[model samples]
Target: MNNIPFYLAAFLVVLGVLIVVHELGHYLAARFCGVKVLRFSVGFGRMLWKKRLGQDRTEWAISIFPLGGYVKMLDEREGKVAEEEVHRAFNRQSVGKRSIIVAAGPLANFALAILIYWGVFMHGSEELLPMLGAPPNGTPAAMAAVGNGELVRSLDGQPVATWDDLRWMILQKAVDHESVVLEVVNERDEISIRRLYLSAAGEQGWEGDALERLGIRFYRPEMPPVIGKVVANGVAERAGLQNGDRVLALAGKEISSWYDLVTIIRDSASRPLRIEFERQGEVLSVDVVPDAVLERGQTVGKIGVAVAPGPKPAREVKAFVRYGIIEAAGRALEETWDKSVFSLVMMGKMLTGEVSWKNLSGPVTIADYAGQSARLGLDYYLKFMALVSISLGVLNLLPIPVLDGGHLLYHMIEVVRRRPLSERAMEIGQQVGMSILFALMAFAFFNDLTRLFNG
Candidate 1:
């Protein structure tokens, strides 16, 4: 869609993979519990491909829509089961076994998240460091005691090691007009502290200003001029710039920091600028002309090169070594639990009017994010997938009638009463669940549509 041909392809691949893994959990759990899974389908509606597998004659198929999938087990509730196979029917299974099968799907999703996150952490993902860049005129940070060449060590006493950390802290804290003490360390080993109070009346307001006052402003970290990305059909790409290239000078002016290069480029829009950079330790010179791009109604020079963090020595990617099987399992469980808790808290905030519902996203938004992550690199993609997996797991566990959590609720009630729910009651619950689920889907779908059309 938005100039990304491979975006849809990647989304489908990831969605398919996650669905297959989730369904496999149900299928395996059913098989182990002495139940027959009649069909294991990835997606819904008409089948695109189908095949029988194992002695169970399980119909493994790919369906038309890639939104979700299911394992249709042989159940007497849905239809009549053969006299011989009635013992293996889903409804006839013990409550514990039924619970296990229902729970397995979400557990599988959680497992996939942990594995993906572990891989990403071990392999290394790109992070933007807070490198000091030029501040806009009249901004809070620029006006209140903060200066150039000063490294931001922390915010509200929390360590600001990366640009992401800085951005999060500032955006979350800026609305409060709170005083922030900046720990600055210079090249001469001199450490100085500066306190800055954000202006509450300014247009650059912080997030949730009414609740708290925590004044902070984000500053670009002062990093060496290293090329991180070269956008396709952009100035840097046309200039033959590649990743890992270090900028030495622009327009014959010595460039020490990323900010210097950015300032020079922005000031030289539509004009030929001479650049000196190093690639593979070999210095080279090139002429680059910046193009103008309109953003927020202002025309700015666009260079199409992403500034990278400091370089690290090349090393082979290695897998994390587990101390023991028990330790690994424990860690996995803890990770999953933490992610689940975080998701629940966030959702609660959203529901309580503390967070905006505008932040809600659907498959289209997720696909866009997935595509962007894929474009970034493998590590980014892995992290994105892990986050998505966690989100999916949390969503499925929500106590809605059509979901695993809903089934668990029914099972719990049955266990307490020593009997299954009535067919009519179950049918009513299903209908209510369908309504709630469809309403949520509609909301998310419209959110996506709004973004697309508005853009």
Candidate 2:
């Protein structure tokens, strides 16, 4: 509740940036193709702001709806065009030019995603190493004898450096193969190969957390219950708890590890806790009440203190992932292309009934994710934006009526027959396309509401 304002702000920022980028693509292409653009809008419906700009006196606008925008070009099909400016109208352009103008919007989205990914890859961040914990009984990992504290070295002969790499490799293989071979190094320094079956994982259609379905979990290192940093004016700081304070116990219960402290504090929200701690060589006690906050519809306690870094080998669990400029660029392109294809494949699966429609997310779900990723950190937020950008590009490129792809499809047919479709035929196609789009939107919105209420 306290973060609603921040969340809304984040969602708006994401929406605004992506919409501008997408519409700018169409606007630029229209200009390049010599098609006179009459208006450049960042949104649709009621206009909030408008300005005439450039030699063309194009009406730039910010509108009420945030989900979409457009580049309205001078077209005889839409409205009357002056006799002098008819030469520069969109309808007067060649099939090739019109196709380029229509395709530019989605291409711009892809380019933006690529650029963002390139910068992010070069900047890098600390990533978790793919170390496995004990798998639950009857799971694939357990059946394959995957040990706790086993660090994954490779998947099907491909080197796996970070947890993301491992997960990606696994997901790619799970789509086609029944089993994947993994090379792992256990905590005892012993290395072994384990072939884990994926057929029973039930992740063929890419359902929830494929890794979790396969019983893959990260190995959590136990750290001493010591405070690394204390939030100003928080319960811990108010109770005289400072950095380097080792918590000895909480509410008469023993606290050996940071996880133990967290478990106790979370269960004792709004309740006064008698905390025993050691500051240097001096042992002391303090009465502190944990702040109660709602998270995912559940109340949890927060003391506002950061955990100290784990000792020795536990520190090796993280790797700073960075790449050179050229490598980063290549990786970014690869990432964008891969995600685009994956999205298309998933959409195809949805049409075939292999994937559930529940996976469709509307603006509400997207806004929630925008808020979440923003809260996670800048890197996470940027990555989330890039992913959404890819999705936007792919969605726009889908060959349904009323989309950029639909226009491109029309252009393709015109190229084949050497003539545009008749007005009545185009109108019928538009009606059918709109119906399909509205049905999808309604279903997606229902899914969003279901998730909210269920949570």
Candidate 3:
């Protein structure tokens, strides 16, 4: 709750930047095509700030609504044009020029995404390796006999470099295939193939973690149930627990390992527990109520204790991934293209009922993600922004009325027919487009509220 203000600020920054980039595309393209831009607004509805600038005296404005913005050009269809400035009107431009102006907005968003990805890739960051732990019984991973501490090398012959790569490949494949073959190398250096069934992936409507549904998890090193550190003013500190204390049991059940203690604590949120431990050479007990906190939108118990340091793992669990300037630029282009295609595929699936519409996220969900990514670090925040930029670009390019793509569509038709659509027809198309957009917004908002309450 205390972070609400920070979250709002982050969301605003993301929205403001993307909107400005989008509108700037149209503004620049219009100016290049000799059309006069009357206003360049960062938002809609009642104007809050305005300033006239440039030789044409274009009104630069900010408005109340934050969701979107516009670059209004001087069009005779919209209003009267002076005889001297008639040649500079948007309607006087060629079809090719109009199409370029309409398409530039979405293009700008895509360019921004590519630029962000390029910078992040070049700067680099630590990423998790695609290492698998023991699969739970009866899951697809178990059926494939996936071993603990197995590093994924490839999925269905496609190379897998990091955990992110693995997840993305699996999602792409699972959308169409009932099974995927994974090539993995175990700790013993033995490489093998594992055919994993993914029929459930489709049935689940892609709602939770895909890896969890398949019983695939990251490797966790086993350690003893000893306290390495106790957080100040936390539940452990309040209960008189200290460093170097070996946990003997919790609520009369023997604590065999650190994981066992964690499982108990997580499932016992806000519940009182009797903790028995060994302090020095003597045994003692303490009563504590685990603190309930929201983690990833789920309520979990925490004792504010740190895991004791143990021996290093035999295999690397993380990798620092970076690329050279040229490689990073190439990879950035690929990433942008791949994500844009994936977004379109998901939307198509929704229309076909192959995927759930609940997957659609609203402003609230986006704000939540912005806050979380910002908290993670600059690399993650930039990646999140890049992803949102791609989404914005793809959405605007959709052939729906009132969107950039819709304007391009009109221009395309004009090219074919050698005439523009009637004013009444254009207005009707705008109305229909607005109605569709509104319905989608309503559904997305409902989904957001559902997640908030359910979580």
Candidate 4:
């Protein structure tokens, strides 16, 4: 409940940026191709804000719907055109030019992704070292004899500096392939090869906790039970708790680690807790009533206190990934291309029944991802935006009517036959395309609902 406003703000920012850039691509391309744009909208349905701009007097608008936007150009197919403006109509353009205009939107998304990746790479972040915990029993990691204190050196021959790198590699392989060979350095300082077989990975594998699917968990350092920062007006603050207070016990139970304290607090939502702590060598006990808050549809207790800072490692364990300008740009392009190709491949697999349709996601899933990434930090949020942009590019290129790719398909046919499809044929294509799109939307929404309820 406390983070809802932050989450919504993050979600809206990501959606607005992506949607505006996507529509701007079409708008620019249409103008360049000599098509007179009638309206450039940042959303759909009822207009909330509108203005006429440019020599063409294009009706620029911001609408109520935030899901998508469009650049509407003068089209003879859709409506009657003025005698003098008929030449500037979208339908009057050459097949090549029309294709360019239609394809520009997705291309813009890909370009945005490349730029985002480049920026993120330039401003690299500190990442946790790639250390593996013991694999769960009967899981692929366990079957392969993965150890608890081993450090991951690389995955499939690609050097991994951090857990993020290793996680991404594993997910990419799992989506398209069935196995991954890992190179790791054990605590004894011996290097060995371990193969993790993901043959059981299905479409549903992509949703939820991916690391859990692989039977892996991040190793967290144990922290002492001590109060760090207390939120203003929170239960901890109201109870007169101060920073640096060492919590010795909660509800008459000894609390050794921060994790133990968290579990106890969460379970005691809206309940009074008798907390014993050491402050300046003085032991004090206080009865505090935790505030109840809704967390993903369940009530949880929150004292609004953070963990005290821990000592830094003797040797720097955090890894940073950065590159020179030229290298970063090249890597950015490569990453964008790879992400786009992988997205397309996943869609194909899903269609072929090799991947589960349950992997499909709707706005709820996207919103959750946006919120999670934003909470992670700027670099993570940028990466998430880049990944989503690539997906938009790839999905828009699919040969379905009413989409950019569908229009391109029509253009190609027109080039070969030297004539556009009949009006009736186009109408039928639109109907078929609409049906397929609606079905996909329904499936994605259903999966989202299932996730919400199950979670």
Candidate 5:
């Protein structure tokens, strides 16, 4: 099935919600500060919908573009205000009040992230075991002699309970250091310390996938070649295969596990293969021609059958993380703070050329991730949203022009000087800020397309 629709919808949902939430913060702050609000706009360009409401008759609007939004308060700087309404102008407010109104938008984004994290922590998530797979030759994990079945115990003396913890620790390390010392426990209950070095190349931590650079992967248990569900009207079903059928052999070769069956099928695309199976304790044989499917750049065969559900691990491969409301709130706060700081540090790295600009992502990548996370479940989707929200908050706080932080910068200058900059100076700053913002957008978009084509 096509995923375009799903991605489009997900992108819209995520962007729309974030923009509205951000603007609402400005709107609320403006109202509380006794400013006259003229318009609240979600998205940009031509108005698709509008309504005037509240005591101020504020015109609420939804517009054509979903890329950005704003809240327009009545300000004397923008235009002349009537005598009676001059007190309600945004420009008439004290510097402190004006700054609060300006800062609220980005702060709202941070608050949203905290709330989402709180909800997710309260609900809990099923976590994977922190087992490490054998690293490829010449990689950091291999260089460290990281063994298979070694459980990641900690990173830099910090206890890491799951892959999430490990990833967070690695990201934080990337911000300020060239390497991290990992502590792992082997199958023999022996603990070892290993150093993992990072590179700006396609080495450790490329494209934000720390595992690939570290040469570590998830370790899963063996899977038997028993069919779970045969796709309706698929090759396997058409060939009379049934659920619970144990695949015995393929093309006269014995099939030991699902891995073996998959390998054979992938290589036998559009070709006839003899499949021997056991159903109801009776042996049967079927001639199946697998459907050819394009994967990556090659054609692969798929029989439309999947392995049966495996048994839950016996206390070694799974973890569930949850907390009571009070505990969850504290954890949520810590989580938000950690992620925010990590984001800021990473941005600093990118600015200083320590990190590649290719790591920057645009709407296309965000949409794709949104769809994938949604498919994973609500918990994953919420996590993705929270992460994005935090990023938005941090990005806006950067002292760049044409952004919230840029406005804050102007206000800060005004504070010390006790007067606003000249209109001409403000205009020049706006032009510079616009240039920087557009350049960043272009880079992000270019990176997005590059990943799409290469991937």
Candidate 6:
């Protein structure tokens, strides 16, 4: 109904793959530790397909809801088992082995992220150059003396090659009278320097503004717009637009590049305009009506067409590539550590009300983001999956009952006290865990609902 079949398919596939990887970690660890795995499932609920391999049962099922999944291991606490099988139950395992098994799932997620990031790097991912474009008038960057075409070499003397690196550096730095230096080179190759002071007051005032206000923009090379794909039944297709057609002008205004055409169309807002183009060395003109669409709280016009690849600007941008088997594993380990730390800090900030709870998202928000990213490309989807996987791993590691962290915490207490927790105590902990989990879910759902209604 949403015409987002690609997004839906991509999200489901990515999520399913991540779930399988995570469960496999636990299953393999259990087997290695002499604990038996009862079932390894990609999705919950009824089974669509299943197979039994030797002593382990594997299921590939389409659950009614594809939000999450789990792996079930044999445990003596759940039910009675044969005398021989009792030795293979999860509860009978050593504390060290149990910890390893419980920790493996999240570690697998981290591994997946590293591999994805490595792949992104090896394939050369696109990144905007660290050039300070024209900041909007009265914004912080403008007031801070940042100007058009000024190259941002560093933040606090830390060299930044890409826009993302600069931005992350700024966000993490303490914004108290920090001096920002700029390295500018004019057309004649004349070098000059400018120093500006950063203040918390100034930064706070410019909050909720575009990245451009923070002195950032993509360095796009000038190129004529060539049609890539013509959508069937869309405005461009109906107007006789074809692939490889070079856009020349719009509404009688001469257009030199794709940026110029985009500006004109966005400002047109569903108005019918004359579009001039060249097809096979023959010039032609057609009337096109731009369709208005709302995105990220702004209204823009679209023609439902893609532009062909053009020459990129001569700027040294940071690029990462896909990882090899060995390199991916190593990078995965590092990424897991970094993401775990970041997640913990964010959680702390959220709890202290330093960050807004509106940042919390549920399934609805996830699906929308997934759809948007999927529409962009496979790389975008992969990045989203990596981030989501990291978030999932971090969340499951929280010291809340019924979670891996909670179970680990209980084991830790048992080791210290020289005895397991009482059954009544475990039951109470389970109830507390459920209550806390349910509340978090409710809050996330409410946030999503608010966003939907507000939009």
List lDDT for all candidates, in order. 0.74, 0.88, 0.91, 0.85, 0.85, 0.72
Per-residue alpha-carbon lDDT of candidate 4 for residues 279-362, written as tens digits (9 for 90 to 100):
999999999888887775456898889999986533345777787788889989988987887788778887787777888999
**TM-score, prediction 4:** 0.81
Question: Please, what are the lDDT tens digits per residue for candidate 6 over residues 1-455?
Answer: 44456556766777788888888888888888988877777776886666766645544345555666677778988988889788889989888899999988887887788778677655656666676655545655666665555666656566666675566555544233465665654334456665644453234333333254454455445556888888888888999999999998899998877777888888887799999999999999999998887763345788877878876644444455344666656655665566667667757867876556667888767777887777777777887888888888888789999877898898899899988999999999999999999899999999878877665
lDDT of 4 at 407: 93
Best by TM-score: 3
TM-score of each: 0.68, 0.83, 0.91, 0.81, 0.82, 0.74
* lDDT, candidate 5, 290-327, per-residue tens: 89885533468998998899875433867898889999
True lDDT of residue 308, candidate 1: 82
Candidate 3 lDDT over 1-455, as tens digits, reads 77779888889999999999999999999999999999999989999999999998999999999899999998898889999999999999889899899999999999999999999999999999999887768889998998878999999888888898888888878887889999999889999999999876767677767777887878777688999999999999999999999999998999978878998999899999999999998999999999998875567899999879998989889999999999999999999999999999999999988889988999988998999899999999999999999999999999999998888888888888889999998999999999999999999999999888876
Candidate rank order under TM-score: 3, 2, 5, 4, 6, 1
Q: Report the CA-based lDDT of candidate 2 relative to the real structure.
A: 0.88
- Give the runs in model 4 whose Cα sits over 4 Å from its true position: 203-207, 221-316
**lDDT of model number 5:** 0.85
Candidate 1 error regions (>4 Å): 130-337
Q: RMSD (Cα, Å) of candidate 6?
A: 6.7
Clashes of each: 10, 0, 0, 0, 0, 13
RMSD of 4: 5.0
C-alpha RMSD between model 1 and the true structure: 8.6
Q: Which candidate would rank higher by lDDT, 2 or 6?
A: 2
Ranking by lDDT: 3, 2, 4, 5, 1, 6
What are the RMSDs of all candidates, in order?
8.6, 5.2, 2.7, 5.0, 5.0, 6.7
Model 2 TM-score is: 0.83
Greater TM-score among 3 and 6 belongs to: 3
